[model samples]
Target: MSNIASILNESEPAAKPAVEAGDAPAWNSTPTTIGFGSVGRMGSGAAAEPPKDADAAAAEPTKGDASAATNSKEDGPSATVPGSAAKIASGDIPVVINEEDMEGQIYSNAAWKDLGISDEIHRGLLSENYLRPSKIQARSLPLMLSDPPKNMVAQSQSGTGKTVAFLTATLSRVDFSKPEQPQALILAPTQELADQISRNIHSIGRFVKNLKVALAIPRKIARGENVNSCIVVGTPGTVLDLGRRKQLDCSQLKVLVLDEADNMLDLNGLGDQCLRVKLRIMPPDVIESVQVLLFSATFPPKVQQWIPRFAPNANTLTLKTKELTVRGISQMFVDCPNDDSRYDILCKLYGLMTIGQSVIFVRTRKSATEIQRRMTEDGHRVTVLHGDFDSTERLELLGQFRAGETKVLVTTNVLSRGIDVASVSMVINYDIPTKPGPQGDEPDAETYLHRIGRTGRFGRIGVSISFVFDQRSFDHLNAITTHFGIDLVKLPTNDWDEAEELVKQVIKKNSAQASYVPKVDDRQTEADDSKPEPAEAASQSTTSTKKEDDKPADVGW
Candidate 1:
């Protein structure tokens, strides 16, 4: 075994290795680690002193007088431009760089000055105590701010400063003299994300004189008013309508960004609308000169194949399927008695862990409403938000959650992706996320990743507890765990006192280190061997994969 594989095997129960892609060579196997050691913390430059506050640490690192050697590699091997098969064979770069070496290659202990951003933008970053560029920002800013402006498809884990990276690119492309003209357009999959991007822009670009940003979500932009702002952020449908109506002129557009690009490009979702906006709305001249940027945390295989066509000749950065799971969050699951008893167990979770703010993800609006009502009656300040709420109401609900007015949020899939709240310390999968598959319904691994990703923001210690009350739910959770090659420590719902102490120990250990490695002995599920036949069999399966034939199958992505 390789050193990374050996390290992982020593730390947790051994999982089946991931299968390499069909066309790739032996050296291109899935990586077992992805820079878990340095996530969400400042490098050697700011190691002497800690961040003033969590919010300050969460801020995008575009400021501070720290020094590190600038990475001098140009836009040669790493940039995944079109027709580059020979480049990979020449040993210039691997499709997926080793996660250990990735930090040195991309982050490289760099300062913001290395990118040559404007003084005004630097001042805005300083106000927020941004000590240095993050991993994503360090890799992407140079390509985004290149003289001729290159197109890019960049994917990093959630809450790793993707918003700041793209926002900085958008701000740098704007011309203050053309304040009333639309110079840049940023499209998000949801209104909440667009609003969050707008807020970040105002926070990070506060020092840029005459910076005006307009939101194109419903009711925010009038029917006939021109979108007269240097930068525009909105949903695809709203932005397309304004573009077709000639209210949002794209003639002067230089940079076009699609946040959550994977979902935006999925045909079952918003892909048609996005394509129309790119091909039908924007004029051909603007299309030729406009720089296209796509950003997301998870890119499904189908979408990955189609992305190169959408953003042709673009530079690409992506992670292997094994690397998709965030290492910082400690994931566990609770074995509830039955479906009906999950509610009482859910209420008991808050007392089990030290949570700053928590989000509970249900599968439906009715469940969300019911949970909100029950939790409110139980004396918890809770908020329920989903697609059923109007745009304005949704924004207001999110605002309340971010301001700490509501310590607990019950929501459906609407808040799953790209919405960042730094204080969220825990996430409960009330109903494990699922989607329609050929076999009726299967575990939605991507949604599960995003839901838990809402916590663990910027490398903070976060915990996700999934509830499984029945055989079907247990199997679904098992499939998800196998898909990611992750071992979810089983939390016993029968004993609150024991569970609480176990949870406290997990959190304390997680907070002290960048990676989570659970011990097999301590993590084994407590099975009811006395139960008859299938129940006893199910319990045995959940405990451990000791038998040779019972190991998880290798997944090829």
Candidate 2:
């Protein structure tokens, strides 16, 4: 067997020299150049002597084998799995290859052509450089596109191509014979997300003849105008209104998709609207025949319990808790001495790395405006978006950011959820997200997950740097990290050069670990405890501290 194959199948560790911390080689060094075998050169080496017997190898106690455990520990801290050696050796973020993910070879290994997609849609996918189906796409597509369509509730990590998976199924199911018939209805939580999904569908189905996609937004279509299109994408309110007014013909609607399902189903804002749309559009008799597909990066326990009622008897696919966070994202945080120092540290971030496009999320609109003004002064093209902006203005500003007219976007939770800008390589949590709880305010873990999810779309490498200035903020962040069971590497504000280097190292190490959990040290905990209290600093300092506006948005979800 090849070295890699043997390594994968072997029950015993290959004896090798152990190196201590100081003597250890650089993590990024090539495996072949060091002592480990390369993936490319796997079969080239001489064969090793055969084991004495299979019975003897089986006789050894695998469970609590001290020598085996010791060898594994001495090898490295990284997790071992098939095809992970190269990534571990090269210091790239490791991806877990699950056996269940590999069970369906036809969907997992086959190309778009092999999936029986149409020529026109296939051309469009190829044009956009989507060579094959993603994991979610591969698993969900066949089930969705089957002879008798199935209701599906899929929970995937952000940016794993959930949009395209559902889109493909929707496009494929559409009957072009009745071009004007609205066959597919996709509802998003926000107008921006709805608009973005509309654009993506058009782009993917560009070559299809008689393809009609209508945006059912307030100003996009007049009040009395009828929506006669093959597919309709819109916010719940607009969709609900159109359905209620009988402007949108849902009689022939074959598919109903809820993108960002958790947000849409949240009881606070759009949930009622979503339920109204579903009820108004689908009569009791036809509801059974219509396919329902729910997609989101998160489905919290509460949401998960509620989804079966929304999409009855749906085929559910979910990522385990440890696997919820996107593997490619390198999560870190900046330790600011004071709230004022956060702005200075924010400006320095752009110079520290090559950022394609970035989003900086703050707690309030006032801070967003301030940061935008300061960032503009620093010679960066900036765009600020918030709930205060009217729909038209919000659309225009988002257009500029999406088209790369502006590189830095500053906003509140308004843009946190489902906005997919492909080139966004970084997300800055200028202020950590929090929600009111019995103990005052606690970290909003779901919102934090969704906020950072903006950048790391479809397995692309991205970074999220959160800024924490006080004990409250620090405790919130710590809680969030603990909740997700992921490590948050600390970045110092004092030294730009040292901070930059440390950030790079953290990214490499964390990526290779693949597991999001970071090993915390006692020194780091001590340092966190020693941070000066914000109230004390405020009294001693000459500059008056601006009280942050913590007024919660009634419908920010």
Candidate 3:
């Protein structure tokens, strides 16, 4: 196992190995011993070792010094994974390139254990079976709960667990006993995400009781829904609707989260509405400020301009856990001379799926539907999903594909982020998303990351094939490579058959790091009322919850 895998296996909470596309090779497998030694032995147990490689240490992100709250035994328990004890006994440890880079090294299990979560909160976390906090959580948790939490801003790629970080911070500040008034207001960009977030809050605060988490959405109002829950997640229009009705009392709100603030402002004219909601509740005297949390997948000039209007004094916390969407996946781009040649290439790629798993991302809804019909008619077990599909149908289709029911799926951008299925061995950007606008509608590097990231996730290895049309497009591909600091290696493939064989050989050669993605059943149904809420939903819709414009230029962040 690589050092990353060994550390995960030793410290991660799951009892059985995670469901994987396949098993890792033995040579890359780790020896049983991890970072365990007697209390006084540095680099083992409780003792700290000096920095590892100097270069990597210098490369570490210089976020402010934020020690996780010194968690107690219950709050931050030692990992109980098998071999943890053996490692302590046999302490010849291997060090990372940046051990001092981990100085605040918040990924340690002790961080959460030391937080000293209340017995009730601890129980919730235990019931949910949370193994360890993501990097974002480790750093943000303590700071949110600090004596005087100055407002803060954090930027991390989506899926690094931004939601729970803020949720825990929000929950920690609330006096559960006195929540009759709004003590917290969470502003999400969409109705779907609002419901999703509400469900999570219910589970996390299950033991907290008396908390009235609520939902404000067009659906709720259109259907005349009543929400007694305190935490509210919804599109801006509906939230503002409730505020205008005086149904919401923001007077006591101590926390405000512009979940996806970038998207929040991208809403056609809704950004103004969101500001009004905040303005209505905030008192001018003494400048009564509420703790604010802002997260986004990409930070552009337009989005950054709106931050001050929402969180004027917030500190910024940037995270790079997902610097490369294909970090864990082997990637290559295939050059398809023309659209007609694509079908012939796909026919060959299909033969590979007969032996393994893969997905093909098309460019449009119409194309996805057409391909689904053609593939299905051609005797393929294929599923297609796009934005046009209703929520229920899309969810069902995803469930079906996730169960390993279908080997190949033809989808559009809907599959870009938030869905987790590590077994997928390949991703084909059937139609690469590029600047499609009349003059400048092409996608940027961030869009490229979301497209390819679907494959290599949760430490699993996968491959991405980007079909380039010309020298210009290949140059654009090169820019994507440079932007992420990843090597977009040229694959040895003159044809589709060769590319398919390449994937098989690659998977056999390099086993993915380790799989910690929760199983369908094992996935926490709700937040355990006992532990702090898991990082806020990565499904954040990224930060602000608004649908992207049909054209890429006006797309929501």
Candidate 4:
């Protein structure tokens, strides 16, 4: 077990008293001070701090992407702040998140603008409107761009520019001068994510000459079409399928990136599919020749089990801030009467967020479908997705969601991992997942974070409402809040009638929208098509419409 697990074991959920209405969770106790709960009070919560100990959620090794620094034994401390250090070590909430925003990190201040990279690559990033490299990129790029390339495992939260981090690494490493023969292979947990990554990378690297990148998503590209590229970003399913058919070969694969590895290992009902990908990797001799990179937002224990099986002693980097609460995003825990009441709450919440994007997460595919049907029947623009949907269907639904065609999305945990769509304003956990780690083959806290994080991104405030129906669900939320170092406010609900309006009010209070739903460009033409038409997204993006003779050899995403 990890250190967090051990610490959590020492204290039961019962240690903290119930939260008072509208109060933040207490991060003053032992083990309740990891992320946002302790940052400096900039707006409403903790105060900010200096950059000396930035504690970025994913701290890259300073030396390089090779190894960790050696630990030293200290004798006695008679330093400048022995008194202050003692207070922090004593588990005081005041020191939980020393939100010391360092104003002078080289990446934040200097170095990148003078990176000395080619003008074309720089233009590519600017054209894509990528303002700047995230903290992860600024710190790791220097090392990643240095010499024979290194195997790295970068752990950062969802939507934190991790995709670009490795994209930069691969772009710098891959020899665009040579034909594309799978010098690097990128694996994602789902087809839509793989598609998004492929598209984003293509757009960023558009200015780079002679770089042929092909996606391995189903129906997008067929095997043996004589495509060439130094990079291949794809879902595990498509990559494995191509390799098995001898259409795609990683014999010359120099780098293997398992983006969102935790999600693959923890995605609900995707264990078998993911395991098959590992089995399809280039044979033993070829596998030993490649450097591996694993990345995720949260690396809970269950998904960690796959480390030994996939990565070869991958170097681990973890960066976490002390303050754990996302003060900008007001969080609430509501007690529901039952399943029916929970559904009612979501319906009411949808009315309040009529102009904003929302997501409702369920525990299973069946529930996702049922809830989606009920909501759609009630005249809501919503869609449902789960492992049950084929790769094409899933990709299409994702397109609609990203395009803002559908105002709300109700689905299983499939979209929860590293799928970034910035417009999401609220996340409703209709059925809170209680498992800390996966059991049998269900997703864990690592996957759950992907769900809630879909909102409150890009400095925009958002809200997350979770319905706690039973003791198990309540305990799960308590454990999750304790781990994240956020205070949980519990609201009691009596019936479905009142629950609806209450849900709507909570959603409206956090969203920035004032009235009518935002108008977006949705090209589809169908009505019971109340759901975003997955067929339409696939039809427009794919070349199936061509008489098969005009199809191109390479189309990424």
Candidate 5:
């Protein structure tokens, strides 16, 4: 366990003050506050505060060699802003990009100039303090920015600058001369993600002349009004509605992006809506010239099989299964005596760790409401967000969280993907995420990855603790670990003092260990030489042989 106290006490660079509403540069018509919501602003559109290891003076080595330097900065109070890329751990972790002809190609860190980015876009990147391209950016930029545009299906772990990679491509493809003409479209599963994407585009493309971005989400675009912007970012349903109404002209669209492709393409997820937008909204003629790009952290085997048809003749860029779990986050699990005791354990965690801001993921809206109520009563600044909230309320709650008005957010899985707040240091799985299956219920490893991924952004230290009170929940968690080849350290709830010390030790040990190694133990390693694919694991039911130790009398808190 890394010393939570020490982690909290570490000094971090001073973050610039949050930019006021309507503070955006002259060229960008979208307000700076559009994506983050109307609440207490957290940070300016400037880049996120980089950790010491990601300092500008740090040297980036050639590809294929991993740098062992770890981020020494902590996600403190001032670091709660979003947008911009502090991704790839400053070249500390090496990323492997798998392509057809370029299988297992390693990419070295390169400057923005290397990509032949326009001077306007280059000035924008420099304004955001983005010095060099991340691994994904270095590899995918050329493929996306080729003479004749190319379609691409790209995957990298969360927080490795995927948003920035595609945004750069989208911006570069846009014809700025006709500012009101829609030239690019970026679709996300949720409005929150769409807003975040909008902010990033503004931050990175700040200097591009006549850059107008319109939010295709509800209330942003009036009924029957044309979506007259160079780039449109919105949810699939809203975007589809606009297109069907003939408000969003697609004849000139040069690029189409699915920010989180796995969820967008999943039959059980948002696949149908996304498919409609592709087939019905954009005519075949418009779809032909549009460069389709799909990007996400994790792409399941089933989704991967069908991605080519979605973006025909597209180049593929992916990481192996073993490299899915983020090396920056410390994964752990808590064994509780019963469901009732889980809340008590949850309350105690805030006192034990040095968390900047935390997110607790529950199974349902009722659970989220209950946790928020109980935590608020206990003197914690907490807020609850779930699907029950209307679009405006959801946006407001998220804005409050980003503004740091609420230190803890209790929510359902609606927020599990593509919401980035750099100051999120802790993520708690109040109830393990599970999807209903033919057998009964199966662990959703993809959701699990996205849930924890919220905390460990931009190579900063992050901690995830999953609570399991029964045999079934424990079994589901175990299945998830096996699926991802990750080892979750077990934390005893019987003794708070002992548990705290153990956490510190775990963090210390993991921080000291080399990067990119899955935390699988030796005993678990021999049992299965081959692991099931994500698609198979979602349907497979399995039990864990591990048993919990006897509970003891608790020491005084």
Candidate 6:
């Protein structure tokens, strides 16, 4: 066994290893350990040692601090400790850990046993191959599962374990004795996200006796049908209508979660409906009993300031703007000769690397359809999804992508956020994400972040390639890179052989450095006099030229 694996095995009881020796090679194959020691020691009566590496150390529980380590045990299982294993094992949440608390501390990820999670739930997680908590889950789960559930405003990079973190909390809070009583509510920005979360809840809570979860998206539930499931996941508008008609009970709701909260709260339509649902649940009598949790990868400055007002006095855990981008994602740009060449360049990408599943983001439904057709002609199993599709069709298309029946998904902004597909190894930004700006249209930094975040989930390596066809597109891409302080390497389109070599090198370097700070070229000018019109104008022209296209010009999520 590897040293790290042995350390992980130390916490398991002598008689029962987490997985048998025959299965260890596949189950514990990763070179490094992530919070496994803390999990192993939970019920085996073993002591966890300090981690040897920084990542493992960050996730390991604190050690050697006698006072901090014993504080929770002395006060019983419900007392909080600043930096101690006792706090984790007792199910007490640590509020904040300052520099002083770091002395001789382990400060690693929380183990499942430390959180006092039920064995059944643990079995479900294990069955799904979730051996340990991700960074976000380790920090947020304890606080979320505490005695008096505290409101949480958590921000982590995309592909990290935000969905699982919130779902774990939701499952833990439900009272299975009354399986028909709705005890938890989860709101997502789109119907796809809601459906995805619902499926995840059912999978994770499968072993929870009598557990029931209902989806409240449009057409999924019929009119006048009451939602008596223990957990309800849906979009804001549908959930609001259900509550208004008394089909969904709010009086017994214990936890309210907002997935992709930044987008949910920023959009006018979604924001209003979300507030209405919250108001219905926060009646004067039960105001203090309900817990609110907000989660997303990015929270703009404006949204950050407004979140506290939405979830008052909430405990916050956020990443700095520079850290918002996932380091594991290798970001690069393909310099195409012109608009016509972009198609050929895009097709060549598949040959350059081994991609498990890929998503191509275009600006309009027309482009999405065209790309789907071209890619299909090139022998790719593709699915096209956009706002033009009805809810049912959209669900079916996404289901195909999730099940790996379709290897390539061509879509607009609808699939940009809160959609988790474990096998997505590459994301192609066919057109940079943009929004209507005072100066025609401009790059959308947040959407760009969320778009690429669709890949590289759960510590897997991911690649994001943007095609820059003209000076305008190049400028927009530059703005996005500058806004996020990203080091986006440029790929040469003239030579396929050379481009493949460079891409491999870039990915390898990025894995080791975890920093992409390309040196700035002071001579680069922003003179757009010779550049083509903005992408939005190009999209409009495409729509007008292809008048036979049934999709609308503004068709997008």
- Identify the candidate with maximal TM-score: 1
**What lDDT tens digits, residue by residue, belong to model 6 across residues 331-398?**
87776777888898888886533446778888887889998898789886678887778888978988
Q: What are the per-residue Cα lDDT tens digits for candidate 2 across 1-557?
A: 13322322232223221222553211110111111112211111222111112111111111210110011111221212112212222334322223234212212344676455799999988766677766666556655665456577666666667888889889998998788999999987667777778888888899999999999876788888999899999878778778888888888889999887876765544555666677656676556578889887666544543455566645545544444566667787776777888898888887543346778888777888888898888886678887677778988998888687877788877777745666677789988887656777667777888888886555556788998777667656655654454666566555778878766554444344333321110000000011111101000000011111111000000
Give each model's whole-structure lDDT.
0.62, 0.60, 0.49, 0.51, 0.62, 0.60
Question: What's the CA error at residue 424 for candidate 3, in Å?
Answer: 4.6
Candidate whose lDDT is highest: 1
Better of 1 and 3 by lDDT: 1
For 380-444, candidate 5 gives per-residue lDDT tens digits of 77788877777789889888887878778887777877456666777899988887688977888
Candidate 2 RMSD to the real structure: 19.7
Better of 1 and 4 by lDDT: 1
**Cα lDDT tens digits for candidate 4, 1-557:** 34333322332121222123443211111233322223321112232221222221221112211111122222222111112212222323120111222111212222335433456677777776555655445434543443334445555444455677677667766777785667888777556766777777677789888878888766767657634677887766667777777777767787777776654554333334555554445765655557677666555444544454455333334433212233445566666655557777677667645556788877677888888888889987788877777767877887888788888888655565534555677787887653433343222333345666676553445667777655455545544554554654443344545645555554554455323222111011110111222211100000001112111111001
lDDT of 3 by residue, 1-557 (tens): 13323332343233221112342210010111113122212111222211121111111122321211111122222321101212212332110111122222223344445553455655555555455665545544544554454465655443455666677677777777775656777876544455556766777667776777766655455433434445666656667767666666566667877765654554232355566666653554212467777665544444454554455534444323223243466766655565566666676677665455677877667888888888788877777876676656665777777687877888765455434555666778776565333565444555556556555543356777776555445445544443444544444336546655777775543333324442111011111111111111111111111111110000011
Compute each candidate's TM-score over C-alphas.
0.75, 0.71, 0.65, 0.67, 0.72, 0.72
What shift in Å separates residue 475 of candidate 3 from its native position after superposition?
3.8
Q: Write the per-residue lDDT of candidate 1 for residues 15-92, one digit (tens) a residue.
A: 222222442321122222211112222122221111122121211123221111122233543421211223222333
Better of 4 and 6 by lDDT: 6
Select the stronger candidate by lDDT from 3 and 4.
4
Question: Where does candidate 5 stray beyond 4 Å?
Answer: 1-108, 502-557
After superposing candidate 6 on the true structure, give the runs of residues whose Cα lies further than 4 Å from its correct spot. Answer: 1-94, 97-108, 280-282, 377-381, 504-557
Q: Give the TM-score of candidate 1.
A: 0.75
Kindly report which residue stretches of model 2 are placed more than 4 angstroms away from their true locations once superposed.
1-108, 377-381, 502-557
Candidate 4 wrong stretches, greater than 4 Å: 1-107, 114-117, 223-227, 265-286, 305-310, 313-315, 320-328, 435-443, 491-557
